[model samples]
Target: MKNGHITQKIGFSALFGCMLITMFFLGAIIYFTVVRGIGAISWGFLTQVPRSGMTEGGVAPAIVGTLYLTAGSILFALPLGLACAIYLCEYSPRGFFVNIIRMSINNLAGVPSVVFGLFGLAVFVKFMKFGISILSGSLTLGILVLPIIISATQEALMAVPHSLREASLALGASKWETIRKIVLPSALPGILTGVILSIGRVAGETAPILFTAATFYSRRYPDSVFSEVMALPYHIYALMTEGTHPEKQTAIAYGCALILMVLVLGVSAIAVYIRQRQRIQNA
Candidate 1:
């Protein structure tokens, strides 16, 4: 009995230590980002248009491009992802083909972002002739975020009680109808959370867009989906890599980092609010 208690205590201590380490790493990252970035953030930095070289510009175009990319990616990914999830959850039989698809999606999620970048460059930029444009980038990011969205949506759907599905069926609802009305409504909060999380991923991505969507310098905002645009991560990367003034570049990078953090935090807050509202409504 004493040995059992000692073993349990040791296990608990190990788990606590692991948790502490994880929190410490996270806190360090947040602290550094905030401390280095806050000084560089201003309305002028946020709103003014960017120019060539680190010393002369703000991230307005990059911000706009990030928004465009994020919006476009969400639009492209959401429908396809939700459809894939619905099909998997509602329509697909628990058979070889379904299993294969599930495995493929899971595998796709593990593929490196750089590989996705190369694929996007080849397919969208070269074969489709979209060039290194926002459209190409959006398509690439859409693909990247799809697996996440699909998995999350599938989990949400699965979480809906089987009884609810049975009730809908007993009401003479078709499978599609049940999914659209009962399953979807119940899973909407989770679905939105997935989307918000995907938005965070899309916002911070550098490699995939590096090959397809971003240019080193863009004096103007993208005029169309097919136009080359500036993006925040790419901007930060460029500044860090190519800028002549180290202080200016570091400052800009910090500022961009700050913006990225705020964007992610804001999206997370909204997702939480949405989930809370959904819980209340469901209750």
Candidate 2:
């Protein structure tokens, strides 16, 4: 018994040490970014167009463009992902076909972002003639995040209590009706959480948008879906790598990074609030 206790203590110490290391890294990143970038963040920085080769003004257009792409991708992906998840989790029988679909989704999730960019360049840009526009980029991001959303939604649906379904059926509810009424509500929190997380990814991704939509220095906000636009990720990349004035551009890059981080964290916080409320209500 004494030996077992010693072993458990050692195991816990190792686990705690790992956790502290991870946390320290995360906190260090946040601290470094905030300390380096906070001075550059201001209202004008958030609301004005860049001037003088992008070293003299704000990133308004980039902010708007990121929001547009994020919204468009979510609009395209959520329903389709939820539908696929429902079919896979509830309707499909356990068999070879289902296994194949599961394998395909897993494979798709493992695909590189740059590969998706190339695919989007071919399919959406050349074949479909979207022409390096917001619509093309959003469609590409939707495809990129589809596997994630579907997997998350499937797991959420599967986590619904089996007894709830049985009870609904016993009460004369059809399978579809039960799913629509009970299972869906229970799973909504998880689905929304997945979607919110996907939004963060869509906002930050540079590769897919680089081929499909982003331009280096657009001053005007995109007027329509067909218009190419600026984005924060591409903006930061261009400033850091290609700008003539390294000092000013680097400051702008750090500022953009800080803004992106804050935006993602804000959205995540809202999602967490909603999820907690849902769980409370369900309980």
Candidate 3:
């Protein structure tokens, strides 16, 4: 009895220690980012246009470009991803072709962002003749996020109880009708969470946009999807690499980092809130 009690105590102690370490690492990251970034952020800094070199200027254009890219990517990716998820979960039969499709999607998720950038440069910029523009960038980002969105959506659909589907079928609902009314509504919160996460990834990505969407110096907002835009990550990279004033450039990098962090955190908070509400409703 004493030996069993000691073993249990050891297991609990190990689990607690692991959790404590994880929390400490997370806290350290948050503290470093916030401390380095806070002073560089201000209303004027966010609203004003960037200046050449290390001169203090605002990041309005980069901010706007980031928003445009994120929105465009989400719009392009969402429908195709949802459709793929539906086909995989509801329609596709177990076969070699289906297995291949699933493998391709999973492999795509593991590809490096820089490789995606290279692919975009070759396909979108050269073959499609889109050039280095926002449209090309958005398309590339959409491809990058597709696998994630599809996987999440599939999980959401699968989470809906089989009994709910049966009930709808018994009530004379067609498969489409059952999915549209019963399955979709129950899965929406999870879908939204996936979208929010994808947005965060899209916003943070620098490599893919570097090849397709970004320009070195763009004082004006993009007038159309084909126009080259200045994005926050690109700005951060440029400042760190080429700015004459190293200190000021570092400050700019920190500022951009802070903004990106805030955007991601805000979206995550909303997802968490929605998930909690969903749990309560389902309960």
Candidate lDDT scores, in order, read 0.90, 0.91, 0.89
Model 3 steric clash total = 0
Question: What is the per-residue lDDT of model 1 for residues 24-52, given as tens digits with 9 covering 90 to 100?
Answer: 99999889989999998888898888765
- Candidate 3's residue-wise lDDT over 96-179, tens digit each? 888999999999999999999999999999899999999999999999999999999998899899999999999999999998
Clashes of each: 0, 0, 0
Alpha carbon deviation, residue 66, candidate 3 (Å): 0.8
Estimate TM-scores for all models: 0.91, 0.91, 0.91
Off by over 4 Å in 2: 1-18, 276-283
lDDT of 2 by residue, 143-193 (tens): 999998998899789889999999999999999999999999988888888
Best by lDDT: 2
Better of 1 and 2 by lDDT: 2
Residue runs of model 3 more than 4 Å from their true location after superposition: 1-22
Q: 14 in model 1: Cα distance from truth in Å?
A: 5.4
